[model samples]
Target: MSNSQFSEERFQQAPVVGILRGVDHATLDRIIPIYINAGFSTIEITMNTEGATNMIQKLSEEYPQLNVGAGTVCDMDDLEEALKYGAQFIVTPITNEAIIRKCKSLNIPVFPGALTPTEIYKAWTAGATAVKVFPSSQFGIGYIKDVMAPLNKIPLLPTGGVTLENIADFFQAGVTGVGMGSSLFPKQFLKEGFEQQLFDHLKAVKSAYESVFQTA
Candidate 1:
């Protein structure tokens, strides 16, 4: 897939990256449509997930409208596998300069995870499209605000602990976007076949996002 397929403008329009981790293929088949229909534009399948590359290729072909990406890419092999399988974007849980440089060389959008101010700045200087403030839960919203106080130019995509209630708060704290997993796609809802409830949940997230960015 061409790097051009990952549109920064589109992502900025609805800056929520739906994370699919450890979800089976059958479940993916059911919920992908719901996710898209609920107004999400970006989704990532973790590389550690079983059959992740295949799922990435399948989703890329099936849902061309959604910006499909690879997450949890820890090494060069993981990065190569992700790119080979048609990942439009790449997300790493740790800041790796080589990976960031490779993605930048390919013109692919890369979000490298970093916790401390030093790591975040290093990731940004290394050509990361955005620095993913992972485990944002541990430090909370105030941490993000503090991080942005000095590094305001670096785009930050906070992952983890992002919920419907505080999704807007994260944005208000100066996050370019957020990555959500269990909080956004509860396994219980999927197991119980609560598709409508899940849909409503996603809609609420979208509404919450718009509430901050005024995309409504």
Candidate 2:
């Protein structure tokens, strides 16, 4: 029950957030334990996905040790609905001051998506728990390293482009953590009975991350 707002603390211990998009209830319920077994301490279900709120609620109730939250939340309504459904945290692809403030008042951590330095700064200043660099693959890890040169004080969570192959590199480049999706949960891996394969893939990613960071 640490909640998603405690990401800074919990994420540092694991540093990987599983992003599950377009997954239904049964599918998510089955695959999520595999993710947890593979060492992901947090899971995010995108709001754009059907039945996302219910998924969050179910996971929160079922997986008390893991932090569950909502992603792709675009507006205040999405934010409100997500919280109502027991989302412990909120993530948006765009910086919305109103939504950020609302989340703050509710004591939930918010990670707003931003691309440019200006937007990143604005989000950070608006009390974003962290700024998620979406489509981070477009700029590459070099961009993250370069951006962190001056803004190193702010916590940056690079998503969208971070893969198992380059995840260690992103951390080396100063990203506090990463939000990974398809790379971790491929479509084929979501099929019934693919749980072991999915678990192995996630295990490999976690192993590689440990090798790179030497955290423990």
Candidate 3:
């Protein structure tokens, strides 16, 4: 595939991806557009989200331009269901080769979670497009630089504890991109009746990234 056709290329350039963890079907219809307008063409809905499979199907059909991924996924059954419901990407909190292989067979991007260098290497060898650096604050940017020094070939997506405040630091530290949840969630938007606050925050992150990475 050409660079123009790969999600990795697009994701890297986007500079940020919106992670909608623990979302429910009730609020999704109103929430998805908030993400779309936030300069986020990619979205991740955790498996534990209420009516996740149904929401994935609906979101995929509604926003054809968005890359909808299934997150917090663990087993083969969840993977199969997620794919059937139109998940464009599959992400897990662990390095499970089975889920990785299934996603590969289906030609979708797979990002398995890893904390240690050994686990990160194993995920990369298993054909993961990228390995998610979970609880990024727990390890910090130094851990990312340390890992990349040796396995520079691997693209790392640092997730967890990724607030808008600290996200730029992670990107500057060489992360492919950051996956954020609570930080990205606009609580006031839902209450104040203006969804644009959330959108603006996302755009702000993109702007920060552009200032740093010329290509972004």
Leading candidate by lDDT: 1
RMSD of each: 1.6, 2.1, 3.3
Give the per-residue lDDT of model 2 (tens digit) for 97-164.
99888888877989999989999999999989889988797898999988899999999999988887
Question: Model 1, poorest ten-residue lDDT window?
Answer: 1-10
Off by over 4 Å in 2: 1-8
Output the lDDT of residue 114, model 2. Answer: 92
lDDT of each: 0.91, 0.85, 0.77
TM values, all candidates: 0.96, 0.94, 0.90
TM-score of 2: 0.94
Clashes (N, CA, C under 3 Å) per candidate: 0, 0, 0
Judged by whole-model lDDT over C-alpha atoms, candidate 2 comes out at 0.85
Candidate 2 clashing pairs, residues 3+ apart or interchain: none
Can you write out model 1's per-residue Cα lDDT over 1-216, one digit (the tens) per residue? 533378777788779999999989989998999998998989999999999999999988888788999999999999999999899999999999999999999999999999999999999999999999998989889999999999999999999989988999998887889999999998887764789999999999999878876752
Model 3 lDDT tens row, 16-44:
66777666665677777766766677788
Collision pairs in model 1: none
In lDDT terms, how accurate is model 3? 0.77
* Model 1 alpha-carbon drift over 4 Å, by segment: 1-4
